[model samples]
Target: MSGNTKIDVSYVAELARLELAPEEKVKLQEDMEEILGYIELLEKLDVKDIVPTAHAAPLRNIWREDKAGTPPGKDIMLENAPGLIDDELIKVPQVLPGEGMS
Candidate 1:
């Protein structure tokens, strides 16, 4: 991209659903040109021999068979609760008016 070429910042902003001021549009146009300039520089790089990779580092899924685990007993869980009712149920603050536990 040539520095002399113009970028339609207003059109780009409209596509992005942005309502940019005149000064903002001017700034955005300059910023966009700089970014495109960088892209142009990148296009000149030689990478024919380099292998394309999805990530910079190799990755693998550490998979294992899904298995059901035993749930903690009611008594064991109740012991950890800050507030309890009937020595079994965990008590929590009401989330909605007239909508607490029956």
Candidate 2:
């Protein structure tokens, strides 16, 4: 690819939601040229037998074995609550005004 490839810096800034200053526009144009030059250099690499991949390692969920265990009772769970309670449940403020039974 030719290093002569042109980039519309102002148009790209609009699409990317950027409010670049006048000096930033000049800097961005030069930086974009360097970035495109790097891509042009990468095009010369040979990868005939190399497989394409999204990452360097395989993607999979790594999880521990699911084992049953004892859990604290409700009385113990509510011991640290800093709010009001009714029976065995903790009480909290209403999410929306005039929406709950109160």
Candidate 3:
């Protein structure tokens, strides 16, 4: 498969809201072509009847029951907190509205 058939870097840059210089565009085009060539080579490999495996080593389901365990009281939970006001609220730097990134 041709690189042109696989990817259009200029179109991708436009979607990403990025501006690339002429040299950068050329470099990216070559890199994309090499990547597509590797993918085409992989497509030619035979893997019929192979059982899909998520990991190489012996695998087991690593999970615990979802039933609730012992719960910490509110006072115990907030005992080591850096900033707390009363039993329910955490004090943080007040951020002024409309003063941050869009």
Best by TM-score: 2
Query: Against the hidden reference, what TM-scores do the models get?
Result: 0.41, 0.47, 0.40
Error of 3 at 81 (Å): 18
Question: After aligning candidate 2 to the native by TM-score, how far in Å is the CA of 4 from where it should be?
Answer: 3.4
> Least lDDT summed over 10 consecutive residues: which range in candidate 2?
82-91
* Alpha carbon lDDT at 81, candidate 1: 86
* Candidate 1 local lDDT, 1-102, one digit each (tens): 455666789997889899999999888888988888777776567788988888877788897889888999878867878988788777788878896576
Instruction: Evaluate all candidate structures by whole-model CA lDDT and list the values in order.
Output: 0.82, 0.84, 0.81
| Angstrom error at residue 90, model 3 | 14
Encode model 2's per-residue lDDT on 5-97: one tens digit a residue: 698799999999999999999999999988887889866888789888878877797897899888988788888887755756677778777
Q: In terms of TM-score, how similar is model 1 to the real structure?
A: 0.41
Model 1 poorest 10 in a row by lDDT:
1-10
